[model samples]
Target chain A: MTTKDIGPKNPVEQGVTQVVDFVDERSGVKNSGRWLMFRNIPAGTSWFQTLGFTAMALFGMQAITGIILAMYYKPDPNTAFGSIAHITNEVTWGWMVRGMHKWGASVMIVIVFLHMGRVFIWGAYKYPRELTWVTGAMLLLMTMFMGLTGYLLVWDQKAYWATVVAVNIFASAPILGPYIGDILRAGPEFGPDTLSRFYSIHMLLIPGGIATFIGLHLYFIIRLGISEPPWAKRALRVQRDEEDARRKAARNREAGLKGSVSFPPAWVDDEQEVKR
Target chain B: MKKADKVAYDKDYAAAKKDGKPFFPYAIYKDTIIAGLAILVVIVLAITVRVEMGEPVNPASTDFLPRPDWYFYFAFELLKIFANQNALTPVIMATFMVPNILIILLVIWPFIDRGPERRIWKRPFAMGTAVLVISGLCYLTFLGASTPEGIAKGETLPLTGLDAAASAGEAVYLANGCSSCHMIKGVGAPGPGPELTNEGAKGWDNAKMVQWMKVPVAPMPSFASLPPEDLENLSTFLNGLGTKYK
Candidate 1:
């Protein structure tokens, strides 16, 4: 199993190594990979961390399928529903793509919330990880909005009325209620123009918002690394502090400066032995 | 870490990594394989199942109920709770306020639970909050799924201040079902009584208001059972509302 004990290193392997060295020497990507993979994460952190990465992978699945769906999805209310029908029945492999995107949205939300639960329970969002938590919250909001906006793009009865109920909810706000409603519906009532507006928001704005927040959230997670669960039998921090203090006190006494301070003469040049 | 613990940790680490390989090939290979497997799952599903569609939207027909997606069914139940009540805004409470409150709680959770303790039992407050929030949502969602969807009507409660006194009065007002008769800031059902939103602007001080409550105008029942202190606090709240709105 030892690599050095293997028969001769193949020329292909040599060439790959040469290429890797060239790229890594300039970009230091090898170091970044090393840092990511070898970082000292707390033990027993396996399952919950998987949820975050799984959500991301699911997001990737959604993006790909959504792009495919959009290629044939017309925004015109007259043809929008027809377009969806055509995609499922006529377009090759279209139904699968659309179905995955639909289920992916629901599953992504579920997994993200589950990941958040783990984070919250472990007290991993404290102090230094506040930004990560905030950004994650933003991501959650944007993802839900994406689901809401995208649901309306189907232009079917269920999607239309569901959207109507949703817009009405926003419109019921005490102040600026009607304005928000108009923004959501694109008019007083759902119409042809409303479909296009929601299409753009669902396909572009909300996904962009999710990506932006997720990007920021992941950046912080990588920087901070994974957090430890407190249930682990960790050593006492106070004990370490006490030991450090004791070491400092012993060093001060050995240097002949224990409790003797008068400006500078008592501590000046004891190591170098310079004359005062 | 004390020196002894540090030495122990180093020994453990060495023993653990004795046969370990660099992450470049080992971990990366595992991650790539997992990613590939995930894609395969998606591919398999895509080949078999299809996205479903319903009839095109027609505003002319009012037969089909426009229900939300499954994720929003809990909200659907919420909308149904205040259905046509005209006295409360279920949408704001169920969809807007509740969700925002949960989000805010999460954003500020780190600050509130600043202790280093992460064990579920050790941090009861954090654990309790998470359990309550998650369970509440799941319950609401379950109810929403079982119920039919309806229009989301809204009610307006314009009680602004969060002071203990003001909030207590607000609670008293609601708990007493004063909203059933007298409206506040366009909230509650329309009643024969005058709007109490601007009660303070009428030049009636706290004493006058309290006395008036004891011996009242026609159609305005006297809340004689109200304690003296609650009367004063309610007066302050009413008076404060007038000034703030103005």
Candidate 2:
């Protein structure tokens, strides 16, 4: 509201602001920027709700390290194991990147499972959040598969046999057993093709699926605001939300426009001010 | 917020202000610290430990055992237990039935437990089942980790003759390194390939032995690269272990 709030004249701050403003302009964050950064959570929201965000952060870590690992890895029987050795011993910081990737995966799984536990315990998946739960389940499957496929990329003796056992497990799917095994192993038994197949899936297909599901999951979370903590007065929260929706519909009707999409608090307030 | 929604949220917001902190520096600040700590942990591990990569793949020799990464020990142990129970027990049950069923249960769990309560005691059935599953997995995984691999064990066929391989077959047999796994009696390290001590006794003539060499079962690195002459000599050497089945 005043020049003083804009900021003091400092070149460094100005440069940073310029870059940020450029990005914000391109991103169209404008009003929604506030929605993302400072949206109203239930007064009862706590650190417990941040588990999902933490899982996402860990996933980003996995993706970064995974991409780097893919660079020097050769998905062939002859060199796959050896290349990993080279990365560990020969490439500088490669071991750290790899170890982080390995540990990150285990940690990511732990965090994701914990996030699910939090969601379940909170009963946050009830009522309107069913699709959020479904998308999350899909994400969970993709994450586990990513872990499985990534295991095969190491090409060591253990990697080979473990994958063989996993492929056999796929073969146990009644009628689809042999066919699934063929697809996974790329043949009747493990060979060169199996490594490449697992590599592509680990690096691309599964990550793609995960990314898509994450988008849907977050979209649902934002559209239907994060569920209130179960300990919060559920009836009161629901009643308030329904009443808000009813009033919003009435205002929309007065403006001769049907209700389109639900608006968060700011836009709703703006509409109300216009109505007044 | 519409008038009613704004009133409700504002009331909560003002009440929350008494104790609640802004999410930005508070939530993201906590996230940054944790993320940095996590990265530090990863870096420490990366620097301190090197993942053990075992010897080159020797499909023919069963000397090297294959195990999975630690996370899969539950499934690995399940298979091991099943195999111990009945060698006839299909691996599929452990591989598909157990894990997939657990996953399906996880996916559908929310729908099944749609109730108004969130207290742990109120959800006794769900909480008990979860604890049981987690404890079982931990126990099984520990067992799996400690267990060894030998379910599909193989034995190397012993043979003899330090200097010669059934006449002129010596060079070809050693050239392709067939002797490493298929040894003359008391000649090489113990291996997992079938004992050729008296492979000739199995009754396949020279031709049959060579044909079999082209493609072998899994975990046996294929010998598809052996030259034709090499194949013939190895076959000769294998067959000439020279003993009667009786």
Candidate 3:
């Protein structure tokens, strides 16, 4: 509600307003929240535009599930496998949590790709939103690294060897390869330290980077405002009207000085235009 | 975009926003619905397709297939295309060049295509690139997924013409789990490694094969720790694949 409604309210509403006002005076958080929530967005913002938010929701899901898994997971080599087994077979609702985490990784990947595809196809990355695309690209790469590092956390035979080959591929890069490999493995070879290292990188480092980039990405999106669909009727009409006006101006110039070279008036009122 | 185009875009966006609805209910409803549906899909998948526990890791064992998750399948498949370590299709293309090029391209795409026209049909180059890249990735991922895992334990290579040394080499291959990567007469996994059914066609000596085994390319672990005699025998067996052992 607007500030004018503050004068008339029930006891509960009055108490809530008092608390909100207290915080608002100190931090101006209430005003900022209102600004964020009540901002005007293009009416043509389509369903496809929602993919980014969906991808973010999945990331939140992953974070919650990952926390639960971390509670029971032991990152040490000797105990890692056993801990996974215990989580899957013994802990209450642990299997469900682990399943959600695993499946969530895959689902997140799908959503992220779809989001990128939507952005690409719509050309939403153009103009003032270039940095938004850059931040989004960072998030995509981080999501992929999240998958790579998280794969090995299971400590299964498949994950272990896949990671070995992956690191080897990194190490195979010219000049910088070997160093990257060593850092990833925490030594020259996979050992006790490798598992914990991956666990830390997966849970801490990449997630932190992703969160930071997400912040930047959201800032850009809000600042730039939502991109309008190119095929929207209003956009097409605008293009047509501009073209017509340009052509008319050229004709009037060709006809020689006709008074002040007049142009058509602005768009009609919303109701009248809709009635047509 | 040009300076004029940028100015026009800002003006148009401002006008659009002025005539638009508030973010509180209009856009939020769509975002919530789609995101909620996505979470529901994840939950349903987790419930129906329960995750299975694979065999525990054993560092000493080379019998395992080093398969990545499905999303990385395209990259894994790329390794196979350039697995030969030859001049034409160097392994570096897969391991270093292509992936890095792709990432760089991805990050800087906005700069690459700065045109103000957002209509899909108007941008042939961008549309073509999108189709090519997306389809290429999908095809590679499909290939990676369809490729079989290494032959099951106790399954032997379907080959002929084994001499005593070659037989000894086959024994070495079977014992060391080379089948996990390579196929001989269509008996092993199709990828992450090249097929070795006609490996002898290369016409290398036993010595060259032995050397390669010790210092192989990335993604292929070294076999230097194997005994000298075993390496020699394996090299002899491999060097005569299509010519002698086929």
Candidate 4:
């Protein structure tokens, strides 16, 4: 309304506005974007709340680094190790990318865990946000699985034996264990195909799952709103005032004024507003 | 939470939001700063602690340490604790049971603790679990990090007996990287495998030892791939440890 008279000062500005309006008219994405950016969050949202975003940012970083690495990397068991060596030794700036990818995996795991711990400590998982927490739990597990599958991509002696043992552990799990192991190994044994299987899983399968779960997680977070710090001064003050009012109402009733009193004044007002 | 509790929470949150600010700038700024710092740290680590190329995978050469990445150290350390595989601490406890239980607990924790309380001090159970889990993971990771590798280069076990058969067995053990998991005579990594300093005390025949090697415990890979003679020699070396060779 304020900008009605000032709409698009120049031809270029007018064109830009027209383009945006055209898209907005059809998709309504502009409104949703605006809502997403301008949504009111509790003022006491702590620094710890940044962990989720940081984890997502790390995931983005991983995707970028992974794409670059995948360009020069081979997924075959025989060539996988040699390709890694080529990347590290011959390719220009390849070592840095490999290092970043390697280091990124470790850092991402740390960030993800810290995020989970923050959620756990804040008790932010309660109530309507429970499903958000569940989605987040899925993300955490996927992140760990990402690490597992990614580790095997290097195809080094350590990685190979370690994965063999890890797969063996999975195969040992009772019932579905062998099947899971077979699927992971691409057979009952670790062969040439195991590398490609893990590569697909590390790069495609788990990342897709993570991205999808992250979408669900963010949707929940935005819809339900970020939780206020439970011990925020303002929140505690509100709680205290409510308790005081309830006590006063109780005291008044106990004083034999129950018939005359229009008690629980604020809460009664809230209830009436709800009914209306 | 009950209906009333949920209603109160919504009302309280609405009031908080009414008094709050938009997510942009306020929250975004913090997120950018922390994430940028994290990225910076990762870049620095990449530069300072460059990743190294290791030996190419040779599945036939079971003479490898089989160490996973640092993040997996807690699980690695857990396997060690339950390595002995007695009834009191089955190997499954580490490989399957404990991890599954912890993961299940993590996923369903929100449902389990469906209370209105949020303050850390007020939620003693949650707080206690947090402390215990955090400390336990840190401790296990530390143990994993500090534990000696399977075997140092050129390290030798201190033993007295050296018959040709036992010597061949010891060679098979060392050649196959058994030290990566088991320690013997104060040598080798103290591991996800039992120490074999007095392995002969078990009195297992070489036949039994060879059979176990062919299909060992869950976490241990089968050595059935080894030549029968090598397996027989390893069994002899392992079986005659404390009883005759000490």
The CAPRI category of model 2 is: incorrect
Clashing pairs in 3: A171-A177
lDDT of 1 by residue, A127-176 (tens): 45778988887787787888888888888776776676577667766678
Candidate 3 docking classification: medium
lDDT of 2 by residue, B151-234 (tens): 222333333453344444655554444444343554442332334565666667877877677654322344555667767776
**Per-residue alpha-carbon lDDT of candidate 4 for residues A121-239, written as tens digits (9 for 90 to 100):** 98899977999999999998899889899998998889988998889989999999989989998997787888999999999899999999999998999889998777775543235
Runs in model 1 with CA error above 4 Å? A1-26, A235-276, B1-49, B84-91, B148-246
Instruction: Sort the candidates on DockQ, descending order.
Output: 4, 3, 1, 2
TM-score (chain A only) for the predictions, listed in order: 0.76, 0.76, 0.84, 0.85
Error of 1 at A228 (Å): 1.8
Q: Using lDDT as the measure, what is the rank order of every candidate, best first?
A: 4, 3, 2, 1
lDDT of predicted model 1: 0.66
Candidate 3: stretches off by over 4 Å = A1-17, A236-242, A245-276, B201-211, B224-232
Which of 2 and 3 is the better model by lDDT? 3
Please write out the lDDT profile of model 3 over residues B1-246, one tens digit for every residue: 766567667867777888899999999999999999998988898888878889998876666788899999999989888876678998899999999999999999999999888888888999999999999999999999888787777787777889999999998988877887787888877656788888999999988999999887788877777889999999999999988998
- When summed lDDT is taken over every stretch of 10 residues in candidate 3 chain B, the lowest stretch is B2-11
lDDT of 2: 0.67
User: Of the pair 1 and 4, which is ahead by TM-score?
Assistant: 4
Give the C-alpha miss distance for residue B184 in model 1, angstroms.
Answer: 28
Most DockQ-accurate candidate: 4
Q: What DockQ does candidate 1 have relative to the true complex?
A: 0.19
